[model samples]
Target: MKKITLSLSMLALILSIGMNEASAQKIKINTKGIGAAEKGLKAATFSDADAAKLAGEAVAWMDANNPVAGPNDPYTKRLNKIFGKHKNEGGLALNYKVYKVKDINAFACADGSVRVFSSLMDIMSDEELLGIIGHEIGHVANKDSRDAVRSAYKREALMDAASSQSGVVNTLTESQLGKFANALLDSKYNRKQESEADDYSYTFMKSHNYKVTALASAFQKFADMEKASGDNRTKTEKMMSSHPESAVRAAKILEKAKKDGLAAL
Candidate 1:
C-alpha cells in the first residue's frame, strides 16, 4: 500500500512529471533542481504533527500539479459514490479524489489525503479497488506514513523544509514544497512495514464486511499483468520487477482467506 506495486509508474521516477488538473500545468523536476532546496532543509526531528503538516503541503502541491478529475467527472463521481460514506475509516479521517492519469497506482499521505488514479479504477472492480484503498490507508493507520516522511527527509539528506531552528511545519515556498514532495515520493517502506500494512488491509476488509477475496484477487491481477508484460521493459515491468513476488503474495492472501472461510474459490 505504501506505493501499491500495481502502478506506481517507475517512469515518474525517471521523468519527474507533474500534470495539473485545474491549470494543466506540467512540472519537470531534475535532481539538480531538487538540490537547490537543500539550502532550506534544517536538520531536526520531524514530529508526527510536523510530518502530517508537511504531508499536507506536499499533497497540496501534488494536487495542484497532478491531473485531478473534476467533481462531475466519472472517475471522481465513482470514487465519491463508493467511498463517500466512509469519511473516517479505521478512525483516520480521510479524503478521496481521482487523478486522471494512465498510471495504475494510488497513494495516501500522512495528512489523510488519498488519491486514486483513473487507470487503477479502470482495471479493478469496486470491491477490489476498495481492497487496494484499504491497504493504502493501512499504511497511514499504522503510522507508516509518519515514519516514511522522516526516512525520506533523511534519505534526501534534508530533514526539515520548515526553515526553523526547531522542528515544526510551516509555510513552504512552491519550490521547497516540490523538494519535499519529491522526497516523499522517493520514500520506500521496508518489507516488514509493507507486510504489516497488508495485514492491516485484510483486517480493514474484515471489519467492513467487504469481500476479503478482493485482496487476493487484486494481487492476482498484478501477477497476471506481469505475465502479460512486453519485450521492452516498460514502467509497469519495472514496477513488477521490484515486486516479483506478486503471485506468491497473492497465493498467500488466498490461503489466508480460505483459512478464514472467506475465499470464494
Candidate 2:
C-alpha cells in the first residue's frame, strides 16, 4: 500500500510540473508595441504558394504573442469538439486554437488556422458559434484569407519570405514576422468579400442541415450588443466601416430563413 501511494504521488507531481511548464510558454502580446513593417505598403498580388508561406509566418508570430489555451483546457476541448464535427471542404486542412483574450473576435488564415477568442465563446450559443465559424470557413474556401495576407504584406517582402524556404525566395526575419502579424491584425475585408463570405456561410449551413435561423439570431445578438454600447457608433457606420451592419445581415439571413420555411420563420 505504501508503494502504491508513492507512485500516485509521483504521478501527481509530474503532471503539476508539466502544467507549469506549459503555462510558462504562454505569452501575452503587447498589441500596441507591435507595428507594421512599412506604412502604406502598396498591396501586391501573390500566388497561392506565396500566400501559404506568409500564413505560416503569421501563425508562428501570433502563437508567440498570444496566449493559446492548451488542449487540456475546457475551452480548447469544447472548441475542438465543435470544430471536429465539421468536415471542411476547402483544400487547406483546418486547425483551431483558442486565444485567452477578452476581445470578441475570431479569424482564419490562408493556412486554415482558426483562432477563436475566449470572450466570443462565452457569449455565443453552440449553434450561433457554428454560424460564425462557418462564415470564417467561407472566407477560407473563397480564398479571401489568401487575399487578405497579400494585402497586408508587400510583394517584395512576401517574395522574400517564400524564397527563403528554398534559398530561392528571400526569407523573413523574426522582426519581419512581427510586422506581418501586425498587418494581419489590421487587415480589412471589403464589403464585396464580406458579402461573398456571408453567402458562402448560408449555403454551408443549408448543406449541413444546421439551423439556418441561428445565423440571423447571431447577427441580431451582435446588433443588440453594439446598441447597448451606447456610443456614437451607429449601426450603419459600423457596418460600412468594415463588415456589413448587423441589422442588415440579420435581415438577409431572416429573408433566407423565411424563404426556406426554416424553424418558426
Q: TM per model? A: 0.77, 0.73
lDDT of 1: 0.60
Best by lDDT: 1
What TM-score would candidate 1 get against the native? 0.77
lDDT of every model, 2 decimals: 0.60, 0.57
lDDT of 2 by residue, 32-142 (tens): 333333233333434676666666655655677677899899898888777786645555588778878644556666777676667668877877777777777776778
| Residue-wise C-alpha lDDT for candidate 1, range 159-238, written one tens digit per residue | 34443446533434455545555667655555455566667778888888998888777777766766777565454345
lDDT of 1 at 67: 71
Off by over 4 Å in 1: 1-45, 157-177
What are the clashing pairs of model 1? Answer: none
